[model samples]
Target: MQLRHFQNEFPYLVKALLSAKKAGRLSHSFLIHNDDGKLADDFSISLAQALACTNPLPDGDSCGNCVVCKQLEHRTYSELFTLAPVSKSRQIVIGVDDTIPDTMRWFRSLFHMKSSMAGGIKIGIIYDADCMNDESQNCFLKTLEEPPPSSHVLLVTANPFTLLPTIRSRCQSILLLRNKTSYEDEKIRGIAGIMWELMSSSNKISTAEECAFAMISISDNLEKFAEEKADVKWDRIFEDSKYLEPPAKKRLEKQHEAAISAEYLKMRDSMLSLIHSWSAQAYMLSCGIPRDSIANPELFPRDLNVISSIDPEKAYRMMRKSEDLLQILNWNVDTDLAFREFCMGVEFGK
Candidate 1:
């Protein structure tokens, strides 16, 4: 997850950052844009390490074995501060805030403290910076305008355009494009791989139940992950709220539920996007497109012979059907029912 790992994908950006670090011309604020959350966060850490590493390689990469690099890896670095959305049911939530929260206030207060470590530059990262409400974003502007002498502020967001123009003006922008090689979910990959296999199979689908099973497996895994995430957040949120009044507590509960649901829908849409891509590629193959030109070659079937028999019209229909299902899901249709109906229609409606 270091800059070196992404050299093949984002060579220009990596080279620029390295050159900046090497020349001592690093900007005080950086706004990195990427919808892929984990990769961006990891790159932020690696960037921070490069900026603060006591001993760096000639190419301005962190040695990774140095004390500062090791501290960052373990999240024990005193000079590093990370602000990401709070978790609600395994989903990161910036929350709907009219004003800044106590945590944000506390984070803002840290600039007053002198670095306890030898590293001169303290790194402050705001993960999902776009999630900040208007009030919080305005409050956060001060740091960008007049940051400490030896501090670097890194703002990471999937959608940079959501930020106020003033905020965007103050920082350098780096856009990280999606690459199939970077996708990491084994189960989703497995489901997608099996899905293409089934679609290309000569045997007609046997029953609605069989088609339902595939979608259900993906849904079940997502639900389980969400539940586990929610459980963790529940313990943390309720364990210390012994003094809240009944009405206030009820309001907080409702907000929490809303945030969880919002996050779940986001995840659902992302999964559906992957399915759409696979189906679109199938359509491409049906039109005699080369296999090498497919965006996600890893998820495609090993054999291309099935493409000869696939009706280009049917493949186009399947792609459109996936888009329609996505729209149906957005309307709050029951996921299982929408997916089942979509699957059955696509597989057997001929």
Candidate 2:
């Protein structure tokens, strides 16, 4: 991730961060929240590179060809540490080890030592930052309060609301956008078709079970796609390390599996959000809003026929219900049960 990549999508954020760096007034910590996980990851990487680069541009952006930048690309930079969840399950909510505090303490200790490179900056990036449990978060607060000089912390998460208030208040928050082209247009159309059909069905109440099943099928297909992508990514890595020691190979395999599972959950959540967006549009349509005025019509053609039949009051109620279900999912409620409840609550054609 480099400044050029986000210059168009997030011009303000890019300019702000770089300007701060150039002015020698960069914040010690930042909390980045957005629906785009990939972009958030890239942004953090770019920040790290800018801070550690030996040759920076006048705007404080990293020179992509520098030795520090190359080392970062190879993941061999000694001063850049990344923290993330270590879940092996396909559950939406993941668990992190209780030793995060210890990790942070050790990181601080390292920062106190002489800089490893000439840049004299140590970076700590926490991906899926919201996954930290209460105990771990409490522990992390200590380090946040008295962070080392010349140290920068980046906390990246899609759901920043789940993070503790104190933690959020201590950091500058930035929001990012999900690139429109990143979504699969065909899959979105399919999901929208299902929603339209469910709304137009003769027996709205009875169709709950049917709609629930359809949604599950879509979710399953998405998970499979995520798994295939992860496999393709890891195949080359494994092939290159065929002569690795037995224990090392086993560890790598485990890590690979966990990564696949995490990717699946991330994809699943994004799919669900797509569905929710459709419902939101349906609600707007129910309220006599013009179709052309609706957001994201490209993702799904507005189903005027079905939308006309839905009760505005009922659609509003269901919209709120869907949001509640999303919160429930974030709280680690059983995915199947929560989704079922949401499907059952959705009402069409009053």
Clashes of each: 1, 0
- Give per-model TM-scores: 0.49, 0.48
Q: Please provide, for model 1 over 1-350, each residue's C-alpha lDDT reduced to its tens digit, 9 standing for 90 to 100.
A: 35787887766578878998789787889988776888887888888888878888998888888888888888888888777667453223333542444345556777547777654679899888877766668878887998876888999987655577688779876656465532355555665765565465543666445656777778767755555556577767776676889998898788777766765665565677677667767876787777776667677756767556667776776775675666566565688888777777677654
lDDT of prediction 1: 0.71
Alpha-carbon shift of residue 300 in model 2 (angstroms): 24
lDDT (Cα) of model 2: 0.71
Off by over 4 Å in 1: 87-102, 179-350
For each candidate in the order shown, give its overall lDDT on alpha carbons. 0.71, 0.71
- Residue-by-residue lDDT tens digits, candidate 2, 1-350: 56767887666568778998899888888988767787777778888888878889997899988877877777778877767765553112322443343244444455456676665678888788887776557767776898866788898887765677678778876656554423463553576777765655654666877777777777658767777879888999999889999999999989998988897877776676776667776776787766765556654455667457876776666655665666666776677777677777665422
State residue 313's C-alpha deviation in candidate 2, in Å: 35
